[model samples]
Target: MKFKITHITTYLFDSEVFLEPHYLRFRPSQTSYVNVSELALTILPQPAGHKMVQDEDNNSVDFCWFEGMTSQLTIKAESVLETKPYNPFNFLIYPQNFNTLPFQYNVLQKKLLFSALEVVPISKVLSDYALSILQRSNFNTIPYLTNLTKQLHDDFSVEYRADGAPFIPDETFQLKRGSCRDLSWMLINVLRQQGLAARFVSGYYYFDMVKPAYELHAWVDVYLPGIGWFGLDPSHGILTGNTHFPIASSAHYEHTMPVSGGIRGSASSKLNTELIIEKL
Candidate 1:
């Protein structure tokens, strides 16, 4: 499938402010599943300088610096890409030893996946909740993961939070309501509590069947030995495949934020974002 995506973000400040450097991760990532044929990014007031850099996670970032002070800032990004369908079960089961409910990683594996394996401590309530679901899956790894995803979609109330930082995993789990990022974080923490390595994924989800059309989405990816990385979307209760165009993936949601920067002047600001994705 091919898609044309346009994203515009505007910030209106109460007073004129000097905009500093901003990191933009709006470029679609290149992977085995997708190809980016064309991309364009425009910053109004015209930035002084801009360049693209790859982060440690290999995510492409546009680093742009501003030279003038302005009360409003606007950023527009457009891209055209082709995506290929991916089989969630295409990889072979991890070749390593696997005899238990919670898979154990050896010393080398643990060392290599240190960043993704690092997880905040989960509460007893959350642990028990995950445990109950695992038991229902008879401690099977894949089924447990997918079942957990399905349960999250069926159980929690989804709030569209386009602004503000995502709630921590505990907060979301206790409230049982959050944005896509919150749900993805909760799923990542829960899987980590069970010794699974998971990470955060930030991207666009093309939902041609939905009213809003398409929008930014968040999901989680779990690492299996032979299978590598498998993505699961708890908000939609589906395994990620074609139509999921990722801009960034990281262990921290804050790191994957598409646009992040600071202003030199202290002034209140209002943020507005618009996204349009259509099949081409």
Candidate 2:
């Protein structure tokens, strides 16, 4: 599938304020399955200096620094890309031991995935919920992930939250509803509790509909010993494939935010964002 996407974000402040350095993760992470043919980024009240650089996870990020005071800041990004279709379950899990629940990575793999493997404190409710899925999968790794993803999607209601960091796993579990980021974050922690290394992923998910509004999407990336990093979407209860175009991924969700920066003044601000994805 080929797609053309346009995303716009604007911030309106009550008064002029000094704009600080900002990092923008608008460029799609190009991989063998996804090819980018054209891309452009435009910013209003143009930055004094800007350059594209790779973040810690190797995601392309535009580092921008601005001067002067402005009441409004706008950023627009456009891109055209083609995604190849492939089976999401094409890879095989290496090392028979890793095929079971409570995954254990090799020494070097553990060292490299330290941050992703770090477990956050979760309530017994959340832990039991994960354990139930594990039992349902008969202690198999792949089934456990599939059952957890599907059950989460089936049991929870998806809410559209425009902003804010994800709610912690326990909170989401208690509420039984959350935005994409919240669900992804909860899933990350659930995997970590089971000794699996999982990371947060932010990107675009193409919905095959006509003239539908879109927003940035979030999902999970689990590091399987032999298979490497694999994408899963608890939000949709499906494995991520070509249509899942990832922009940034990190051990922590905050690092994958589309925009990150600070302001110099105390002026209150209102944010507006619009995203359009069209199949070509």
Best by TM-score: 2
Runs of candidate 2 with Cα error greater than 4 angstroms are none
Residue 210 displacement (Å), model 2: 5.4
Residue 206 shift from truth in candidate 1, angstroms: 0.7
Clashing pairs in 1: none
lDDT of every predicted structure (CA atoms): 0.87, 0.92
Q: Report the poorest 10 consecutive residues by lDDT, candidate 1.
A: 94-103
TM-score per candidate, chains pooled: 0.95, 0.97
Residue 214, candidate 1: alpha-carbon lDDT:
56
Clashes of 1: 0
Worst 10 residues of 2 by lDDT: 207-216
| Candidate 2 residue lDDT tens string, 1-280 | 8999999999999999999999999998888899999999999889999999999988999999999999998999999999887887887888888898776787898899999999989999889989988998999999888889999999999989999999989999999999999999999999998899999999999987665978899999999867888888999998888999899999988899999999999899999999999999
Candidate 1 local lDDT, 37-135, one digit each (tens): 999998897999999999878889999999978999898999998988777777667554542476688899899888889878888998998899999
